[model samples]
Target: MARLSGLFLCGALLSFACQDLGIAVEVKVPAEPLSTPVGKNAELPCSYSTSVGDSFALEWSFVPPGKPLSASHPILYFTNGRVYPTGSQAKRASLLQNPPTRGVATLKLIDAHPSDTGTYLCQVNNPPDFYTNGLGLINLTVLVPPSSPLCSKSGQTSVGGSAALKCSSSQGAPRPVYNWVRLGSSPTPSPGSMVQDEVSGQLILTNLSLTYSGTYRCVATNQMGSASCELTLSVTDPSKGRVAGALIGVLLGVLLLSVAAFCLIRFQKDRRKRPKETYGGSDIREDAIAPGISEHTSMRPDSSKGLLEKPSSASSVTTTKSKLPMVV
Candidate 1:
């Protein structure tokens, strides 16, 4: 019994010495920040060095925030380049041999669940002396909805004019909610504000005025996040009144074009209806007299009476004028 007691005392002293020398038997993995997503693999990296390889026992364990570390079962263990068996880890965890000869024992997790997030520890122990140990922490964050709404105008508005604006999002989770925001800088409110189809998230300003202009923003949000956009607004001066003036100018232009076209068409139709005049004489004449003082009428050589009437100088009188009735 005395010998056993002495041996126990020696073992305790050796443990104290190992701890004093920083022989990490029970140790921390990493105290820094690390994050992982759900349903993905996460690696818990660890390494240790020891003087006694034959008696060294390397182990890995995980405990959530409030739980005790060693009280729970170890996830994985390695000893002398060989894997030690822990039956439950078969489905959820495995020991990864990353730089195995250098005493690096990394824990690989498959299909990590939300509950798997926690603080992990790596421990090393020898029969008479502790070698190395470490602690590491991992944080898992699940994404949420988008937030911070923004509304804006696409084009500038003139006084008493119409304008369109587009509202959109910058960042958020999938399927975010969108809305339009109308804000005024002045203390007094101008009450003629109107929005278009609020369900579709479009804003239309009709009959815009200087007082109606201010700032506009489109806001988008979700359960996990929120965002907003803003822009300064101003309307054209009343003196300019470009909206109504532009409309009037356009109407005037259209009216002038229509009048010009009508005149051109009437001129063309009149010219077509009137018989073409050639040297002030008709092509064919029956009872017409030539422009001369003779009472008998002169006929063209191509007329029906051309063969009847002999080719005479009197018929081809240059100054002959026909007594034809005036054309209506």
Candidate 2:
């Protein structure tokens, strides 16, 4: 009986070790970019290919951009047939072992942020000297608000014209959503074409015209927040051919107005600087002749000071007119 009991104990310990330290050290995850944003949850899944009912250990860790991996930075760890994680990670990370009958371990991240973007590795351990390599790598990227959308037009040989526009964004933690709206008209009843490119988040529009012209808007939304770009379109009319004439007329009017305003201002400034003297007044006439001379006589050294010095008797003489005075 004692031997049987000892055998059972040993088996139990073995099972526990397999469930804890002896997990497949390597896991398989997709090798692609993970789209995430701040204040949201993200998932990094890993699975192991092993016999059913086999026990193993799984660990998930995130290494900084340039840092190497180690047990100290483990986000989640499965050991001693139980799960353990850092306090910070424990609150946000979860594990799965249901298919533990097979070897499947996955970690879910909650309240993600841009700083969370990094390289993540999933490891499995099966003990005593058995370890395996991770199946793939998961690369992550963060996205920023999208840039303003651009609208363009195309001319058809038979048709008048068509309008096209594309919206694009970049540098975000998670993928962003795009929405377009036309101004001054009812929303489009038919679904418009929009595609996310493999290389960028820009959306493209093809075959647009005056009808398509209006206010164009591109809105980008993520877990963190949202942003938008708006533009007003001036539709093109193929039938309008006198645009140059209209532009010329406007330019001419503006030029004439500017000239009139300038002349008026100059006249006011000159008027302010000149004195307010009336024309043809005695003062004005005297001032005008002051520069030439005043009607005063120069005195000789012996001239008398009073009127008694005047000549005693004046001989009066009258001259006959050379010609008869003309009568008006």
Candidate 3:
């Protein structure tokens, strides 16, 4: 009788201690992450020990990726035989089983979006029997494919110089990686002459040569799908350019010399055939003494010969003086 009384006293003290400090409760949850495509339903599995009572309660909360639990906001909760949905997802959030009193507190989400991608916390408290972490964590992800990437190039593509190829996408749920490939048959690049960055989507080439001239393609890829773009590089030789320019200059110089020589020869022929000025015929001078009339006198008739031989003035005077004296 004395031992029985002592045992009852010890049991009462033990129950009082349990009431002050809560006991451990077991919550069952999956070890793997959850996933679903956009615009589809998703299930985050959670459950606990069958500790149904008048004050039984359960809560589901969420936070974005990389955020702490302290930042989580309530999505839905159940207590006092009533279910209340809350937060931004309240309209589409619900429980898998009516009144999760049967131990199934799995979260049900309808038409999930990329914004819903994050971590979820499920907690349960059965009064007088819960204390040590009656909670579980779940990670959810939304799958998405890559978008068309923009292709571009930088630096001159001349021989003995360097060039870089770039590619990028404007929108994609999961960030994508890049890859490059030559369109036609291409020789293997020397070890140190080429460099590529898959994350940044860039390919750099040094010591460019004529063999590097070709069309190249870039592909952006993720878990869902891939998109691609294309670009071309044409390497030119500097020596060939110099040779062509010199040949053109020489041809122009020859053409100019030929034109100058033709002009000089034409001027000489025109000078040799030129005529001289004349001052004869109608332009004769009218001056000086009269010409002799001897030729005209000889051509006259014979009767006129006596007139041409008539006397000198001195002989006529001498004969006239004697005749005048005799008459007086």
Candidate 4:
């Protein structure tokens, strides 16, 4: 039993000596996630506690959202007291800690895009300091401002009916949230006769009335910025609408009838002014010859004998034989 006790004591001393000779390397980063608006710079904080040696290396790598760590690629590297940036992030990324030999390994990224949102790994390698973990993780989020929203109506919205007004914005990071307001009204629109959908950005107005006619505004907001759009709603009395339509139709019919009558009258006048055509005939004149004496005077015997006698010239006389007239 004494020999076993002596062996356990020696083993404990050896374990303690090994512990004293071991070098610890630990990496630390912020516990909270980091965020920045698009087109801005982001600084990833990283620090380490290690028994570093002359042969030390620091590496910064990125793993895109939803990707495995094995798929991560190097963003920058530090070795031999020199910094080397790599991949697409070479021009935009740099070491915040110059000579990064004093346990500082922060990285600065400029002009961050939405695609830059992901996980970053900071790893430190000191040859003789390998007992403790030497890696840190950082999560970054990139924000994009909302674009102008589109507003539209989906129903007739007449009196005693229903309608739906919708608003949407397609461009924004973190998905934009939407709100609606009735123009010229309070900031929080009264929800007395309408149903609002916060998720879909739709408003349903039930049993609509003329009082609902006005301008409506839609606002979309995200972490970065906001945008708005406005639309007008007009309501007309159904009875007045029908009366106006009837009057318009009657006036149009009257106009059509007047045009048809004018066209007929013009056609008849043109026909009357045109020359008439004659077929297969020559023209005869009534004044070509003079009329003879009256029949009663011609029947008298004395008138007949005078007509038979020829007139004598001043130098010569001519005689003609006469025939007696028979009474029948």
Q: Quantify how close model 1 is to the true structure by its C-alpha RMSD in Å.
A: 16.8
Instruction: Return the lDDT, model 4, position 258.
Output: 100
- Candidate 3 clashes between residue pairs 3 or more apart in a chain or in different chains: none
The 0-to-1 C-alpha lDDT of every candidate, in the order given, reads: 0.63, 0.58, 0.83, 0.83
* lDDT score at residue 114, model 1, on the 0-100 scale: 54
Error (Å) of candidate 4 at residue 150 is: 3.2
Error of 2 at 128 (Å): 2.4
Candidate 3 per-residue lDDT over residues 39-154, each given as its tens digit: 89999899887356787899999999889989999999899988999999999899999789887999999998888999999999888785666889999987667789999999
Model 3: residues with Cα > 4 Å off, grouped in runs: 1-23, 170-175, 186-188, 247-328
| lDDT of candidate model 4 versus the reference | 0.83
Report the lDDT tens digits of candidate 2 across residue range 1-328: 9999999999999868865754434567877677665567787777875432324566677776666555336687776567777745678877755334356676788887666777777766554434556444566554444444333333341224333445555444355666666556644423453333433334444444445545667666666566676665555555454687788899999999999999999999999999885666444553242332333322224345543232323332232355868779
Per-residue lDDT of candidate 4, residues 29-146 (tens digit): 9999999989999999999886667778999999999999999999999888788899999999998879898878999999999889999999999887654678899999888898
| Alpha carbon lDDT at 75, candidate 4 | 98
Candidate 2, superposed: residue stretches over 4 Å from native: 1-26, 31-40, 49-57, 64-72, 98-102, 134-136, 140-226, 229-328
C-alpha TM-scores of all predictions: 0.35, 0.37, 0.67, 0.62
In candidate 4, stretches whose alpha carbon ends up further than 4 angstroms from where it belongs are 1-19, 66-70, 127-132, 155-162, 170-175, 185-192, 197-200, 222-224, 234-243, 250-328
Model 4 pairs in collision: none
A best-first ranking of the candidates according to their TM-score comes to 3, 4, 2, 1
| Stretch of 10 with least lDDT, candidate 1 | 136-145
- Rank the models by lDDT, top first: 4, 3, 1, 2
